[model samples]
Target: MPRMIFVNLPVADLPRSMAFYDALGFVNEPKFTDETAAAMQWSDTIVVMLLTHAKWHQFTDRPITSDGSSSLRLCLSLDTRDEVTEMNRLAGEHGGTADIDPPTEYPFMMSHAFADPDGHIWEPMWMDQAAMEAGPPAQTDA
Candidate 1:
């Protein structure tokens, strides 16, 4: 089978989380959504599962931590820099806040971070293909 990744994140509320992700242009997969879990599919290999705190805790023994007052960050890349800024603006309009100060203009790459409804950070990044080709091979965990 092809490789796949399912990122499970704890959310305080399902509906609000759904709305937040919707604003980010992520389509929710109803087939995998329920009262406790909302599946946000970015692509074939990228599946982000937004699960309620209680539901998430059921899968792990560790206590679930509230996102409030926490500065942890989560990063996700995009295809273009315009998409990054657009998502950031859309996120802010839909109750998400920019995690970073402002847009960073670079010759090769661009990035901007945003925090979701529950203060969970999300970074949208873009790296120029030409610049990447000029550099070393990208690193991967596997």
Candidate 2:
């Protein structure tokens, strides 16, 4: 069986967070959703579990961190630079913040970063493995 990942995050508002993730192309698994939590599927093997603060505390004794104060940032890869741009646009359109940083273009990859409504940072990126293995391109004047 293939390994899978389920990233669990604490959200202030389950519905609002669900809406925000939906805009970013995740489909909610209704069977796993309720007032206390939502399971958003990013791919066949990847899901993000959004839990209410109270529900989250039931699993961990650590204090809840406020939005924008989180230590971990989630990153997802896309097939093309265009997809990264589109995801960032959707995030902003659905009440999230885009332009966490200007889009970056290295010889091998391109990326855009944004924040969800709860201020959890996400980076959507595209990469060319061939270019990456070849190493960074020689510097040139802008």
User: CA lDDT of each candidate?
Assistant: 0.82, 0.90
lDDT of 1 at 142: 80
Q: Estimate each model's TM-score.
A: 0.85, 0.88
Clashing pairs in 1: none
Top candidate, metric lDDT: 2
lDDT (tens digit, per residue) of candidate 2 on 23-81 = 88999999999999999999999999999999999999998777457588788999998
**Model 2 RMSD in angstroms:** 2.7
Q: What lDDT is obtained when candidate 2 is compared to the true structure?
A: 0.90
RMSD (Cα, Å) for all candidates, in order, is 5.1, 2.7
lDDT of 1 by residue, 79-133 (tens): 9988988989888888778644576668788888878877777888899888887
